[model samples]
Target: MDMSHIPDLITPAIPVFVITIIAEALWVKRQRAEAGVTLKGHTWKDTLASISMGLGSVAVGVGWKVVAFAGYAGLYHLTPLRMGSGPWAWVLLFFLEDLCYYAFHRVHHESRLFWASHVVHHSSQHYNLSTAVRQTWTPMTGWVFWVPLALLGFSPEMIVTQQAVSLLYQYWIHTEAIHRLPRPVEWLFNTPSHHRAHHASNAVYLDTNYAGILIIWDRLFGTFTPEVERPVYGLTKNLSTYNPVRIAFHEFAAIARDVARPGPLGQRLGYVFRNPAWKPKTAQAPEAPPPVEAAHPSP
Candidate 1:
């Protein structure tokens, strides 16, 4: 199988993504109109912001592809282990690539440096199909995660294309239009229900269900959290702007600020390597002298 010609599955899927997003928007609008239903349906500005971010990501990814292929091909040549280019190879790549995605997704959420890129997708407060296209400007971090597959004998082409397939498969799961599937399917796959929980900023939902295609990885890794209530989507401290530049670079600027603060080197590094929610303890001023207590603190 000549895998080099496996055209990007995502670029061609844009029209489908558009049509379905419009349909989901209308459906969600109607659903929200129903009695006792209170969905914060798609906002035009938010959707446009997502589209802008998606376009920026593609613009940057065009150049990144060469780096990715070269990185993978270089590794492939270093090893003698070669899996035959057959259907089985693709099947194996599918499962292995997903596990790689699980690791990539989990780490991006847990670490501030990576989260600075992945956060673009979750920047929207609305959970609609448009959110699926909200890609990152720094997608370079994503491909390197799968380079290990090349050393295991899969072609560089196969490694790249399979990653797109996993991403394309995940697009539809971003919509709130579809609810839960059958129990068995829900148990095995990453459904909208599961992904909704993953997108949620609710305390219980934070850092859970990091699956790309299969939910099994999250289940086995103890990151799975079922969606019980409708999720409150977006960051715990949501952004106030719709500017694409700000959306793409906000967290990075935040990391720069945190790292620049006067502190121990390890504490500064923590701002980059630690959880996005992690904060350094502030120095406390010594308590007022007992003599001052007689006057009581002025309000």
Candidate 2:
């Protein structure tokens, strides 16, 4: 199989994805029955929405890949380093590509514009295998983060192949099916527990664990948070609808509205580039102080 085409690596996995999702669905059913109550594990609407978003992501990636390949190839032609495709080169790229992904994933959470594209993955309230497939349709912009890899002598095809491997590694982490792996594996790699923390909307869990294949990046970057409490899955400001169209572009619409509000150019720019949680000073209200009794301790 030609590993140069990114979609080629993913298309063959489509059947595997479908079969695993079905297996997870059965597992979900068993979990509900064993608990003797309905739980927030999976629903037909949410699973369908996730699958739809996955398909949309694939379509967008296939179309946008040409643009990405051109940029990478252009830079690679000018690169001083000529990295070979030997096993050692692949090993070097495996780590470098994963590091690039860590940076990309972190930025996607930190920046509003990028978050608009990334929020689709986190929009689902359920934590299941299907949620892994719920990827962004606007992944074209994410290619910029890996430009350095190509310039450092890695071929565009090698980069794409390595990225596909990283993505496949992450797919299983989206499920609650596996509680935890062996301690060594859990510590060294991105496992379900680490990813669950990453997916959580819990106060302490938010904006943590941005690893792709290796958890060490998050640990080194101080973004690692353990699974201490049961995670509250989904976005902090959860969406009420399961419509795939809305799910894909709602944050983009929100960014437009926020930027169009009467504001200085700086504030408008901030709406696009600042953290997703950031707001203009004029839009933010002063926090009310705590009660007098709580603020001032009794002597």
Best candidate, lDDT-wise? 2
Error of 1 at 185 (Å): 0.5
Candidate models: Cα lDDT each: 0.88, 0.89
Q: TM-score of every model?
A: 0.91, 0.93
Candidate 2: C-alpha lDDT: 0.89
Global CA lDDT of candidate 1, please? Answer: 0.88
What are the per-model C-alpha RMSD values against the true structure?
A: 4.9, 3.6
Candidate 2, 202-259: lDDT as tens digits: 9999999999999999889999999998898999889999888999999999999988
List where candidate 2 sits over 4 angstroms from the true fold.
Answer: 1-7, 35-39, 289-299
**Model 2: lowest-lDDT 10 consecutive positions:** 1-10
Candidate 1: list runs displaced more than 4 Å.
1-6, 34-36, 283-299
Per the 3 Å backbone cut-off, how many clashing residue pairs does candidate 2 have? 0
| Cα lDDT tens digits for candidate 1, 9-91 | 77778889889888888888887777546766689999999888888888887778777777888899998999978999989
What value does the lDDT take at residue 292 in candidate 2? 78
TM-score attained by model 1:
0.91
